[model samples]
Target: MQKKSSIFTATHGVMTTEVGVISGELELRTTCNDAGILTLAITYVGAEEWYTLPGEDYRLHDPRDHEVVHRMLTNVLERT
Candidate 1:
């Protein structure tokens, strides 16, 4: 498996005025097989906790996976 991570800041604002902020992190991990099947696990930066939105250790077969993950993370940040 291969892994990469990054820290991200989510900010809430209205009409150019900043209202709130949340620090978020994302980790992308992958494993591939000889048959070309790829599995992706998306988690918080350090915890290695798999999220339900992107699936619990989701497969990389769907193109919408990235967007779904992004939305889930955004929701988490906003609610914090």
Candidate 2:
């Protein structure tokens, strides 16, 4: 199973991406695949297109921790 979570956050500074660093009202999405791989993406709120986050992908030691990781990411990114 794949699990996903999203949050609206105002980034403190520019966030690096494949294109470049962008700042403003962005939406973050964290997805965890069945293989325990976590993928993170972001986009302008309500936008259809999504971009990969800085780190790209991560391998979670435990898939069940995706929720906590998602929350932690939200807390970190939401900092103004």
Candidate 3:
């Protein structure tokens, strides 16, 4: 599995598991398994616990697209 993480500030709240919505400095984690399945999670920066992003898991037709997907999500979620 390949896992990537990026830290960003969410000017608008992001919907997440358990916590409902999270804002401010947060970390986005994208995990890709051998089967090209992707799962996304987020957490407060420096926090040990991670929360799953609602409706964020899916299968990628190309595993190499993981990096691009991760970058896009980071940019979109950053807001400003």
Best by TM-score: 3
| Residue-by-residue lDDT tens digits, candidate 1, 1-80 | 33333344434411111222213454444444434344544455667445422334444565435445544544554443
Put down candidate 2 lDDT per residue, 1-80, tens digits, no spaces: 56565555575644657667766777777888778899888877778888887764598899998889988887787877
As a TM-score, model 3 comes out at: 0.93
lDDT of 3 by residue, 1-80 (tens): 99999999998889986989889999999999878999999999999999988785599999899999999999999976
The candidate maximizing lDDT is 3
Each model's total of backbone clashes = 0, 0, 0
In model 2, pairs of residues that clash are none
TM-score of 2: 0.81
Higher-TM-score candidate among 1 and 2? 2
lDDT of 2: 0.76
Give the candidates in order of lDDT, highest first. Answer: 3, 2, 1
TM-scores, all candidates, are 0.37, 0.81, 0.93
Once superposed on the true structure, which residue ranges of model 1 sit more than 4 Å away at CA? 1-23, 52-80
Which residue pairs clash within candidate 1?
none
C-alpha lDDT (0 to 100) for residue 22 of candidate 1:
19
